[model samples]
Target chain A: MWKAEIKVLLKKSVLDPQGQAVEKALSSLGYGNVQDVRIGKYLEVSFAAGSHKEAEDQVREMSERLLTNPVIEDYTFELVEV
Target chain B: MKFGVVVFPGSNCDLDAYHLVKDVLGEPVDYIWHQEENVSGFDCLILPGGFSYGDYLRCGAIARFSPVMKSVVAFARSGGLVIGICNGFQVLQEAGLLPGALYRNLSLQFRCYFTYLKVENRQTPFTSGLEVGRLLKIPIAHGEGNYYADADTLRRMEANGQIVFRYATADGEVTDTANPNGSLTNIAGVCNEMKNVLGMMPHPERAGEAALGSQDGRLIFESILKNWEGAR
Candidate 1:
């Protein structure tokens, strides 16, 4: 079995509106050195695959098609034996 | 012209769209369930607002994979008119029918209000009879309505008049404060490069009649009707 940990974030050039709001809240609470903040999503997916390379390829396909929106977001994944 | 409104699993506004066409506009309309693959016998297609696929992965992302979408995409490619409103707009972006994507509101709030819109391009069938820079009072309800496109794509759209509407002051100025959702260039609506497809974040069906508080929205439907009539 293989487990995939996926992370999705808004493109660097795209505005992270919710992240900005959280950053502002942090600063007002005296966390002045917060610098910047960006929000992202993490997903844990497990499945049976022939090999780790096959699992990685499958995860890549999933991310490119459904897990992320190419227009506004980007995604990356890491696979491990479970 | 007959209309077909696609009803996906989570569509809440399909009935509103049907009412707008059948009861309000006095036109023939039909409901196309999400699983169906055929979209014949309809001149125009409407994708109404609501959370499809429970908006699980992303708004419109999963819905784009619906069986009916294949036919809708084909219809659009054949130059048939398609109107996507609110969540429908998000679906079109996912379906690649229209340019750009919508993001969460800058204020991180679901906004529901009667906002002002400026007619950006009046030459297209959707706004042919409308005056340029006309101010339209329309209601918008959504949490993710901030429109964004790459600078190059936006420039091309500008040159081709793909932009159809922009949030504006009642006096017709496109200013920072007039923007409700922080959309790039105050964009509220846009058409495909061919001008056959339009995706907008406003709820035009909700504002279709005076009893609903404004009749401005009816013009969009009427425009589509006339376009169909004029073609033949």
Candidate 2:
């Protein structure tokens, strides 16, 4: 069994309305020091595979195929041995 | 026809879609959980719209990681018919099965109401029941429905006839106000290179019944069935 941790984020130039809303709310709460805020997601996936290379390949394929939107988001993954 | 509708934890449109297919269209359908891994047997797969994963992180961000997406992607890549409406469109974009990204409505508000769309290309299997330039009235409810793609990408889409729908008014006039989300070029929907995978922000399922004030959306499902039946 192998595990992969994936982190996904919107591209830098893309506007994040939810993040901006949270930032505004924070400012309203007097947390004025927060300059910039961006939001993203973290996912951990586990699958059974024969080797680290196979797991890595699967993880990469999954990221491109579904885990991340290459047009507006970027994703990276880390493998864990089980 | 055997159809599969993917259901995420926070998806509210699954039942709406299931009923739209099973009851309204009188077709057999199944509700596939997001964590399920296999989707090979279904004739069509639907990514119904809703606030998946409570719209956390990004609109369709978390839901994109669901295990069902793997099967969905594989199904689409194999030229299977897949439709993503509204939030489903966001998930398709977030899942990299379609081009462009959905930003918040230009006004930065959650918009919910009926809107008009122009059928841009009827050549695809999804829109075969409608003629090009026909107007369709559909409801759209979302905050992140504003579609954006780079200039070159937009040009390519136009050149390749990948653009399937554009926001329009009841009078068939294409205007910015008619475009609820301020999408680039007023695009409301597009398909992949194969034209089998469709992603559109308008909720066709919501407008399929006369009780909903319009049955124009039924043509889309009819189109799919007709095209598939002819192909087989």
Candidate 3:
């Protein structure tokens, strides 16, 4: 089985309102030294594949097609065989 | 002219769109199921607002893969009119039929209220009835309606006149305070490069009747009808 872990975050040009709210909360808790915060999504998918290369290709396709909106977001993934 | 409204699994505004076309506009309309692959015999198509696919993964992400979308894309490419409202706009962005994406509202709140929109481009079939800088009172109800596009894309859209509407004050001024979602440049609506596909965050259907507060929303539909008739 191959497992793919994906992380998606809004591109730098796009505003992360949810992250801003969280940052405000942290500041209220005396974490004023923190520079910034950006919110993102983490997803894990496991499936049977022929090889690590095959798994990597599948994960990339999935991320580009549905896992992320390339217009406002970017994604990174890690593939491992189990 | 005949109209078809696509009904995704979670579409809640399908009926509203149907009513606006059939009862209000006195035209023929039908509901097109998302699972169906064929979309013919219709002059225009509408994708209404809703939490399609339960907004899983991301808003409009999962629903964009619906079978009917393939046909919708082909229809748009063939120069057919397609209007996406609110959630429909998100779906259009996800499907790559429209430029840019609707990001989470800057206020981190689901805003449901009346907002004034300034018509930026009056030549589109969807806005032909309005004059430049015309103000229309429309209501927006969504959590992710803040429109975002890269600087280069925005510049191109500006040059192409693809931008159609912007949040504005009652006096028809585009300003930050009038922007309900902190959208870039107060953008509320845009059209594809061909200008046949329009995607907007505001719900014109909700404001189509005077009893609902304002009938300015009808102008958009009227514009489409008038322009379509002119083209024919």
Candidate 4:
């Protein structure tokens, strides 16, 4: 079995309203040094795969096909043997 | 003309679409279930607004994989007319039937208000009866109606005339002050490259009658009917 940790984030060019709101809340709490904040999703999955190479490719495809939207979001994955 | 309004599990606006078509528009319409796969024989298909699949994972993410959406995507690929409203618009974007994705409102609030929109494309069957640049008052009800896309895709969509509607002032000026949801470029609606599919953030059904506050949305239905009539 292989385990994968995936992170999905809105593209840098796209505005992150939720993140900005959180940033404001943090700033109001006295953390004024914070310049910016961007929010994203993180997911972990365990699946059966033959090899590390196969798992990496499969997870990448899954991220592109369903886990992240190419138009507005980007995704990255790290795979490990379980 | 006949219409099919797909009713996903949490679709609150299916009935609105059905009532608008059958009672108000005086046309034949059916309520299609989310699990159903066939979408044939309908002049147009509507994916009504609501939280499909409980909005799990992401807005329109899980619902994009629903059984009916497979057929909806197939239908749109074959040049069938499909209109997605609000949550439906998110589904269309997630299903790859349309361009761009919706983001949480800039204010981080679920906004329910009347917003003015400018008709950007009169060539589409969905807007053929309406004049380009005409301002339409429509109600938007959603937390994630702000639209976004990469710069390249945005440029291409603009050049291709895929941008169909933009949030505008009452007097019809597209500006940030008029953007209730903070969508990139103030886009309220967009069509696919083929112009057969449209995904809009506003609820045209809700605003289709004067008693509801505005009758500007009626023109979209009228435009659809006019197109069908002309084609037949």
Best by DockQ: 3
Best by TM-score: 3
Candidate 3 C-alpha lDDT tens digits along B100-204: 999899998999999999999987999988899989999999999999999999999999999999999989889999999989999999999999999999999
Docking class of 1: high
Docking quality (DockQ) for each candidate: 0.85, 0.25, 0.95, 0.80
Worst 10 residues of 1 chain A by lDDT: A61-70
lDDT of each: 0.92, 0.88, 0.93, 0.92
Specify the CAPRI tier of model 3. Answer: high
Q: Write the per-residue lDDT of candidate 4 for residues B1-232, one digit (tens) a residue.
A: 8899999888899999999999999999999898998988887999999999888877888889889988999899998899999999999999988988898899899999999999999989999998899999999999999898878899999999999999999999999999998898899999999999999999999998889999888899999899989988
RMSD of 3: 0.8
Cα-based lDDT at residue B118, candidate 2 = 95
Q: Is candidate 1 or candidate 3 better by TM-score?
A: 3
What ranges in model 4 sit over 4 Å off?
none
Winner by lDDT between candidate 4 and candidate 2: 4
Candidate 1: what lDDT?
0.92
Question: Stretches of candidate 1 above 4 Å error?
Answer: none
TM-score of each: 0.97, 0.79, 0.99, 0.97
Q: Write the per-residue lDDT of candidate 2 for residues A1-82, one digit (tens) a residue.
A: 8889999887876776668888999999999999988888799999998999999999998887666667778888899998
lDDT accuracy of residue B43 in candidate 3: 93
